[model samples]
Target: MKSMTGYGRSSFLCENVEVSVEVSSVNKRNLETVVSLPRDWQALEREILTLTKEVVSRGRINFSVKARVDKAERPEASWDEKRLRDDLEQLRIFAEAEGIPYHPDASLLCRLASGQKFEQSLPDPTKMTEGLKQAAQEALKAMIQTRIEEGKHLEADIKARNAEITCLVNELEVSSEGISALWREKLLERLRQAELELDAEDERVLREVALFAERCDVSEELTRLRSHGELMNQILEEDGPVGRKLEFALQEISRELNTVASKSPSTEVKRLVIEARAECEKIREQALNVE
Candidate 1:
């Protein structure tokens, strides 16, 4: 079992460069990935997504990569004087032809210098690929472990709430017994007060009571509730991506509880059904974070 929320970070050295990766995730209905890499290393975004998919089946995952060379190993940024002069002359000619003012300043030179500075600091993606993969894997491992620990807590809470639902269902079953007969007796009492005598043994009265019982019967819904509960427990114990299955099971459980609430004539039965439904809802909310 695993949760859909977690965070992990790892940093490692690759040749003269230090590569760091951070991965985090939040609950989502389906799998999604957002990758953030240094502009120079953007080509690795697809590879990062593929690696993330291998570990996460569901969630909105965010991956970020940062790399820098050690100060001692960093190259000094220098401009090609001939190239810079050529570029300046070309820009001046274009500006004059377009009748636009052209002013070359220290800032412009610095801007051109900074471009080379940035490139000098960026490590080659091909050389950093192996290190990035290793760092990403380590970070993912940490995140998965965090998810597993949180999942244990979620499982415990879900199971505890499910047990509450089971107890409520049992109460509903016990309280619902003989409800049809009670309704029939009340009907007879009402008829007697109205000067209309209806014997309990009369064929019409018996048929009406039978029809009432059939309408109010919640036995089938109760049976399915128990079945759904068992299935949920099995789902909780199974390996990998149980959130969807758990959500489906909770939907079935909620449906059964609704049926029981609607058909049950006993006030106590309806109350118990409501309480069971509440527990199912709580479990459903918790299941949203499961993976």
Candidate 2:
């Protein structure tokens, strides 16, 4: 079992650049991922998302990348001082030959100071892309480890609650005996209170009691509920994403319990059914965090 919520982080640093990746996830019915990276590295976002999909099949995942680079250390940022001076000298000679009054303003000097000052220094794009993917993958690996650890806790808690539900079911079953006779007696009492004359052993009364007993028979529901419980155990043992499947199975289990609750006339049985339903509700809630 694995949980859908977790967090991880990784940082990579070299002489000229330092980059870090952080990944966080939360419970969700489907896998949804969002990535934020340096604009220069935006092209690599797809590769990171692909890596995330490979590691996580369920959850709402959010990730971000932060980078710091020493611009002066890059070849691109180095000033072309020789080229700039050569161009300036040629322009000065042209002006002297044309006999024109030339003014070399600060703007031209600044422009010629560097080819592209705004563009920051960076490592090779291909290697940087691969590095980004690797960092994100490492963070994802940590996040998945955390999820697995949390999942072990969830599985144990759910299992204990399942046992509680089973106990309630058993209690309801044992308390359901003689329910038909009790309902028949109560029906006769109601008739007496209404001032109607009816023999307790009358053919009509016997037939009504038999019909009521058949209606209230929860044997099939009990059988199905137990079967569903066993199936739940089976699913927990298997691997892969089982949150949605477990959700559906719990719905079926709850449905069977509801049927049992409706058919039984005994207050004790109803009480037990309520407790069992509560346990099932807890299990359903926990399933939302599963993947």
**Over 4 Å off, model 1:** 70-74, 78-116
lDDT of 2 by residue, 148-257 (tens): 99999888888888878877777777888888988899989998999988999989889999999999999888888888888888888878888887898899989998
Clashing pairs in 1: none
Q: Kindly provide the TM-score of model 1 when superposed on the true structure, using C-alpha atoms.
A: 0.86
Model 2 global lDDT (CA atoms, 0 to 1): 0.84
Positional deviation of residue 198's Cα in model 2 after best superposition, in angstroms: 4.8
C-alpha TM-score for every candidate: 0.86, 0.80
lDDT for 210 in candidate 2 is 98
